[model samples]
Target: MRWTVHGERTILDTPWVRLRSLDVEQPDGARVAYDVVRLRDLAVATAVDDQQRVLMMWRHRFVTDTWAWELPMGLVEDGESPEAAGARELEEETGYRPEVMRELIYAEPAAGITDSRHFVFRAEGARRVGEPSERNESDRLEWIPLADLPGMIARREIVSSATLVGVMALLLDLRA
Candidate 1:
């Protein structure tokens, strides 16, 4: 069964977020106003090296007030493709440019309330061209061994939805 969306009214509209109330009709014949959050799509890069390690950054998320490891990522700009945005963000945030990138996963983490999509790509390899241009993106950059991912995740160090999905998929792939 699928819910029918009669219409939607915006409660707030901004560059970063859009909030709306949707008039929906349930399959069982109940009508309700459902609140939703719309956010800019994100592009994420999971860059791995020859040694089975992935490039990551330690950063503080002001919203959650927590520091954790994450893949280089950013919002996809209006005129750029997700791949291009991922490559640009990788260099800007980590000073690494991927030689080649391929789509890894797509996730709508909070689909229950938010329509934000995360596009994750795997970088075949990357080279450091210079220091990170985005000064406040992260506190430090490191190449973490993939073998340690389970422990890190267990410790709650890798917490971002996109990062978790991408790395978990990678881990799952290794089993096949």
Candidate 2:
């Protein structure tokens, strides 16, 4: 069952997101308008140290009003490659620069609602150079044992989808 596209219009466009309205014929042959969100691609880094611990940050998200532990991640800026963006975001968010970064996984967190792709990378052997770029984003940074992931997720401590997926990928890699 394919919807026939009648027309489409850009409702709003911005650096972060673009909103579009599309007119299409439904399965019942009725015409309707649907809204779509176009977002920039994001990069997430799962930085693991020599001790085989995953680097994580504890921060408060204003929109969700919850404090959660998450991996370092950010949007891939224009003209930047996913690998570069992952390294940049890792350094910026955690103040640790990875010596080796490899793409681990790529996923669409919400394919139904948004057009945003998240690239997850495995960063091995990172070194803390200095303090985080700022203190507002994260109040504490720590290396958590991978074995503790299940408990954390069950407790709702790790809520970010990118972070969860990245950690699961890391765990799978370890098992393999």
Candidate 3:
């Protein structure tokens, strides 16, 4: 069963996010207004080297006041493909350029509240170039061993949704 959207009014509009009030009739015959946050699509990458180490960043999210390890990611700009954006973000955030990028998985984190799509890619290898193009994005960048992923996750050190999904998918793909 699907809900029928009768109308939608913008509550807030910005380059990064758009908030809307949607008037809809549910399949259960209830009509209501729902607030939704719409976000631009994101491109995320998991870059792994030949030594079985995955490139990661240790960062803090002020909103949650938490520090965790995450993959390189950014919003997909207009006119830029997800793969291109992923490659750009990987380099800009970590100074590592992907040698091979393949789609790992896509995730919608909060479908009920936000229409945010994350395009996750896996890079079989990467090479470090110059310094990172952008600073203050992370406290440290490290090439973590693949065998340590489960421990990191268990320790709550790898907490970003996109990173978790991408890494798990890549692991599964590797097994296949």
Predicted structure with the largest lDDT when compared to the true one: 1
TM-score of each: 0.96, 0.91, 0.96
Q: Decide which is better by lDDT, 1 or 3.
A: 1
- RMSD versus native structure for model 2: 1.7
- Using TM-score as the measure, the top candidate is 3
**Model 1 CA deviation exceeding 4 Å by range:** none
Query: Candidate 1: global Cα-lDDT?
Result: 0.93
Q: Taking the candidates one at a time, how many backbone clashes does each contain? A: 0, 0, 0
Local accuracy of candidate 1 as per-residue lDDT tens digits, 1-176: 99999999999999999999999999999999999999999999999898999999999999999999999999999999999999999999999999998888889999999999999998877999999999989869999999999999999999988889989977776677
lDDT sort, best first: 1, 3, 2
> What is candidate 2's lDDT per residue for 11-127, written digit by digit as tens?
999887799998989999999888889899999999887677899999899988999999999999889999999988888888898888898999998886788999999987788
**Residue 39 miss distance in model 2 (angstroms):** 0.6
**Candidate no. 1 TM-score:** 0.96
lDDT of each residue in 51-77, candidate 3, tens digit only:
888899999999899999999999999
Query: Any idea what lDDT model 3 has?
Result: 0.91
Root-mean-square deviation of every model: 1.1, 1.7, 1.0
